[model samples]
Target chain A: MQKGEAFKIEVNELALEVTSHIVNSSEIFRIVFSDTRPPLVVIESLTNGRPFWTSVPQGRQKEAEFFGKLIEEKLKK
Target chain B: MCYYNGQKVSKTEFLKLLQLEKALKDFDFLNKELSTGFDYSLNAVVRPKEGEIDFDIVQMEWGFVPAYIRNREQLGKMRLGYKDSAGKFHPPLTTLNSTAEEMLKPGKIYREAALKRRCLVLSSGFFEWRHVNPLSKKTGLPLKATINYPYHITIKEHEYFYMAGIWQPFIDTQTGETVDTFAIVTTKANPLMEQIHNSKKRMPTILPDELAYEWIFGELSEERIQQIGSYQYDYREMDACTISKEFRASLDPTAPFAYEDLPAFELSL
Candidate 1:
């Protein structure tokens, strides 16, 4: 990773880190973004189970959505 | 100083992460091969702010300074030794690394900070010296040498690792310069380190991922802190390589240089 210039940093806390993995004879690069304490939205499942998903705060909603789209696009590739 | 460290984070990523573009021009260090010794040196350290679970990556001076020192001059005197009114000359104070067992004892200089100001020191690797008294060709007696072979040690497969550390903030009364200083906590050496750092028989408290997290966020009870502070990172998980005697000046400081006469380890890795 050092020679390849691959790097990973958490948006939640920006420590200088890099992560790399080899998959299917090809090197895959990923950047992981996380929130330390994210606001969660709880939803009632059909079987009365509570499932929670993270919510993006004001002004950062666009960044959250952008990352969501980026992940989706990467998955499609 | 046991922890002669290498913290080689590039400037571009560091600025982008910290959003410190304004300070970019003034930025230096974080790419140093060896970052601490008798003199002051800078290294990237992870410190948790008050009321914050997550930590910020900040550059802190490696030599710890106690808060009671009056000013910058006093700090110099305290570190380099100053003769007392009775004209007794004291030795230079070494605060680069603190003994994990002794740091928390009552009335200790590091006691208060160890309890409240725990932090993690980030390192690409650290350097330690091994003394080898080679037999003299003429007499077969040992020859005197100060620093023999130098070893650059790091955790295996870990690009960078965290060492347990305690930080203190110093405010200079004369210059009003407020800077964060830290001391790496060290414990009794594991077998591998027992060979490499033979003189001191001590090694930095390199924390694993889980323990590193708990050390920063766990309950601050004296026992818990001391337990983690005294952790001896398993020798099997470490990688030690002998570097050139001129490693501090070599282009590739960390590249392994094999010594033909370096003794084979009796203990298995």
Candidate 2:
């Protein structure tokens, strides 16, 4: 995906807003929870799927789990 | 410095252990997540109000992003170690662990956070690698090679302990996005940690249960902060063991957390 290409996906109770950024010649996909508190749950995944960096804010377990599963499902697709 | 950390307990268990079930009613984001490297986030307890030791745990990125980094461009430049010859924009140093000495020094990136924005990083255990060079057995000659043995360290008596930390809020000027990040405080390693973390001889400033309250809420001068930062826990109260090298390999969340009793290779002293 080109830099700034973004989209939103919703599955069941979780909603994710994914954005792409070009960092050092690699694409980093930063997927954040659309509905979350101050420290939102953000997953930074590489296009190659080698490194999946997930960040979950305090008090948002359900959102984090759903986000994780959604990323896994998307990767499979 | 602690790069990898493990928080094996659930939020309910952590709250019960810390006796914050009533004070903190709604927040339940903490879980059994393990970190192997940077760019990940962890939960930390911070005192947002003075005279109140009761605090709430918040998720913060492991690396501290200084406020001066206004946008993605600046972040990229800073990460690439960009700095003017006059020392403008600060040096490109790792923000994962801010040493106590560095925190006390004037004009340091973490000085303000050190004095004002202290917090407690909760962890069941932390990981560090020890460097060893051994002679070649086949050639019977000294080999020019070094092997890193990863160790998981934890307090002996406590299921979970607090490591002193400082946090900051960074806002992207362009997008107005905010991210809370933190850096673990480190001090001169105690006898045992010195042996384990031989290269740097630095260990996280792990506070005792009683001191945890003071670390978060107490008022003190720069000298007192330095003293608190330099305080060392007894090495006997801590434990360490070798873990699989896979801990250093990838960012897989499901990677094995098993500890090995012996190092993979024998070291020739």
Candidate 3:
């Protein structure tokens, strides 16, 4: 993303395009949000050093609990 | 002057940044989202026992408060350190932008912090405004009023910018909680800011990327500190476009003032 320009939704697509740019060169860009209905999300890997994405179950109480469980489960590995 | 949610922001933006609800809320959910790198701590970074720097994440309060006040009397004796309200301490030291001059003063609160407790304030932008008219002298009608005219500017950018600052470790002798507080640093405005700030002054000295580490730990020498004034960033490169009055309305609910295409206020000698 350019310094002065504001972020727009379409420009924020996951796939890379020739003209697209990331804001401020942040090494880690994680976008975690909740969507109730499924197409249960998944990620394989990256083509370049681009942004990383993730999705988890969404809820007020459930979101936090799920996040904690995910971390604990990951740590067990 | 600008507004957020229709209210004037004379009280300063520190509290708004530190609020837990706001901090936890993601950027896409809000009108703006500031990136304060993962390591950025807005509050106290709990030091690991045995004096080891854990680098573990912890948040901090947005503003600096010295760690020693135990009672009302102790808080009362603390200097409120604003250039304007130097001798008086009525409003108390809630939030403030510090100064390079104050940091160098032999026995000032800032000087001591500069030597031992330097800190970095994180933000994406700040607000400064140009005063068109003075507010009522008696009523203190608007914060925009009292500032030195022509040079006085007001800002309400719906954005964020990291400000250079310092912190002190405040230990509660009673509760035994060790909390850390901080202050922002202000310097003479750059040329462009001089035009908008109108008075050749801007608060919260902005540091460059290269100087980040040096500024935090390097020797507080006369030559090194002078760079803040002599070598400030180019103020002109940052452009100023008229922000929408609707945005202004959201910022100052009480003002209910509409945006007018009046001539820009000029600096008078």
Candidate 4:
């Protein structure tokens, strides 16, 4: 998906394989109650790999902020 | 400066390295090896009338310019070194990873190159990191460790290998000289690579010894890449051990380990 669009990620299960198929889907979840609401990201988690599903916003501002905090911490190295 | 499989090879060793041996004492060993890794450059501008293959070394940039940039600063900004490619300036999508599953479809640059302008990237070894331990819950410390792991799955000994690559010839907007740039093809990570490249579950599509030529010329059919994808060897088939290269005595294969140790983690799926 491009920068600001939201799409649902669908995970398929099979014998020994966990595949993610991005489905044609959308959601209207708002990050804040302000007039200009931020877009929410819906990412599907694959069962064969790491953690289960979690959503970040369409602009991914929170995710970006979290990553920025991580970088700042690592820079102290 | 890199080991193919496990054996260290120098520029002097390349020609002899290509000479594959059928068995010990085989007279045709040299010729067989030469045929596998050695091939002359073939491009529209360098097409041979009678058709000849001449294998030689040439310098090329690693990042592509898209044949659209007309500014020197913009071109320079795109130059990729290991650290530079990992920097904030480069977008995640542009950092040399576009999966075949995504690129095989129409309209992708990889699909375009695969259909028409396929080229080979010659290299001794590329790097991958294995997590030595899960991140410590208490300290929030990363246990990622760099390893000079060698490729040993498909060879009796160390031998140079080629990763499947595609290149585009672009004219430098300011210099007015033609330059070639390339990106390596990646696929779903094999079991051997899951521990390393732990962050991203992907690995480069390494061309097989017998199939390197076919892969380079787009002579390989879609069926071949698919079939080859199914044949990736397990980690057990490869000798995967972490060795330090940055710490003193780290480059020594016999050096004692100093990093955090964790139980072996294997990918089941």
TM-score versus the correct structure, for each prediction? 0.72, 0.62, 0.49, 0.48
For candidate 4, lDDT tens digit of each residue in B1-269?
Answer: 32222334432222222222111123222112111111222211111111322132333455544555565466545443223554645632252544656655766656665555544554434455554445667888865653333221232233345556656667756778777656666777777677666778687676554445445433557666544433353445344444454422233433334345444556574
Candidate 3 backbone overlaps, count: 44
Backbone clash pairs for candidate 1 read A8-A18
Write one digit per residue (lDDT tens) for candidate 1, span B65-170.
9878868898898888989999999887889998999999998899998999998887879999988777678998877964478999988876567899999988
Model 2, A1-77: lDDT tens digits are: 24655667786776777665432123334566655644333343322324333333234445444565665677678
User: Compared with the true structure, what per-residue lDDT tens digits does model 3 show for residues B1-269?
Assistant: 21222222211221221222233333333223222222223543221222321111235545455545673245434444332335643544644556676566766666666666555554545445554554466986644534322221222432333356666666656667665666666777666676667544564576553354345545557657646423455453344443333432244322223345334535341
Judged by DockQ cut-offs, the docking class of candidate 1 is incorrect
Q: Write the per-residue lDDT of candidate 2 for residues B92-200, one digit (tens) a residue.
A: 6578888887787978889999899888887767888788766677986766787677778878856567788888888989999888888888999888887778889
- Candidate order, TM-score descending: 1, 2, 3, 4
Scored by DockQ, the top model is 3
Predicted model with the maximum TM-score: 1
What shift in Å separates residue B25 of candidate 3 from its native position after superposition?
14
Off by over 4 Å in 2: A1-77, B1-19, B22-28, B80-92, B138-142, B248-269
Q: Judged by lDDT against the true structure, how good is candidate 1?
A: 0.68
lDDT of 1 at A71: 38
Residue B228: error of model 3 in Å? 3.8
The lDDT leader among the candidates is: 1
The 10-residue segment of model 1 chain B with minimum total lDDT is B1-10
